[model samples]
Target chain A: AQSVTQPDIHITVSEGASLELRCNYSYGATPYLFWYVQSPGQGLQLLLKYFSGDTLVQGIKGFEAEFKRSQSSFNLRKPSVHWSDAAEYFCAVGALSNTGKLIFGQGTTLQVKP
Target chain B: VTQSSRYLVKRTGEKVFLECVQDMDHENMFWYRQDPGMGLKLIYYSVGAGITDKGEVPNGYNVSRSTTEDFPLRLELAAPSQTSVYFCASSSDRNTEAFFGQGTRLTVV
Candidate 1:
């Protein structure tokens, strides 16, 4: 069984400020990792994913995450966040054994203040 | 030039719900669930990651699915085990992650 723990429930940052959302996972083997975003009333959207190779994986909307084997963490970071960047972010673990079933974290609600 | 089919490769945004395609596709039903009405909940399944379920509750399948139930990726009587007293039981759809009607919304006061 796999699960994700997102320490932060909600985050607030200035529009131009940098942002970092932490994520930790529990898995038997090296698992597939992903980050997704959701607006006020919408579906979950993929921001980035880490499957293999390159500890650091870049994704859409200038977002990126690093897979740290030692820490068992894949944290999402952005140099500067835009107003639209404010949304709910989730960390997911996609197990190889399971085709595409992702175990998701509770989710962090990001608030970008202008 | 290639003519677009009824199926549009509609590029929406970074917010894409793409059930990723893998080369060695050994499907074990990969479902990404989302609550329908109020809050987001586990309301969808992917009998096979690539195959969209058929019509209504339709198990419409695609050709890319592999057969290997030995994986034993079955969903039977799972429990979130929240303090919420109400218990709701309903069959789920392993189809598109976006479309699902009749969802259960349980809130604990």
Candidate 2:
């Protein structure tokens, strides 16, 4: 089965500090990858994704991810963290994708210390 | 707009649990998984339609398609994986994305 791994369990960054979240995946071939954010009392939102083309993909809310196939990793980054950026981030892989199932990572909770 | 909604029975603030889609296509899903660390992968989905959407909420899950009917979500919480299952799709391309639910739950027993 294809799967995703998020190394960072929890991260505490200053409101103005930079941020990065790591995600690793196990699959037979290059698979569809995604990053989502979940805030308190909210739903999971799409941050960015890496499927093909540019190794660096930009997304909403000033977020971006660099896909390093050599490392089997797609990392999310933001130049500066914001207080509102505090949330749980997830790295996911589309598995049984032909079947439409999405395998998600354990998730990384981000805490912004103002 | 009258959007679709998903429901279940969950506590205050726990992670996990997901939701629904369609087998007709290969996208979208609804989940109601629970238990230890990760829980059961509930509500697996692939979009049954063609539309594109990002998450409307932080913990919620949703998606859209470009050429088919996509998997939208309506969530409450999470339930057991033994409950029900149907309509799940999965397809991937450069700009295409997957589908998911915010998850619905009702922890009993």
Per prediction, fnat is: 0.04, 0.17
Give the alpha carbon lDDT tens digit for every residue of B3-108 in model 1: 1111212222212122223233334333233432212323233454344332112121122233322111122222332211111111122111221122122221
Segments in model 2 whose C-alpha atoms lie over 4 Å from true places: B1-95, B99-102
lDDT of 2 by residue, B36-101 (tens): 234124333323344333321223434333434334343333234323222222344324654434
Each model's TM-score? 0.59, 0.66
Scoring only chain A, what TM-score does candidate 1 earn? 0.96
* TM-score of decoy 1: 0.59
Quote the positional error of residue A84 for candidate 1 in Å: 0.6
lDDT of 2 by residue, A1-114 (tens): 677888878899999899989999888887788898877544567788877899999999999999998898999999999899998888877664354446778788899998
What is the per-candidate TM-score for chain B?
Answer: 0.20, 0.27
Q: Which tens-of-lDDT digit does each residue in A1-114 have in candidate 1?
A: 577889998899999999999999999998788887877544456688887899999999999999999999999999999999988898877644433455678788899999
The stretch of ten residues in a row with the least summed lDDT in candidate 1 chain A is A94-103
Instruction: State in Å the error of residue B83, model 1.
Output: 15
Candidate number with greatest lDDT: 2
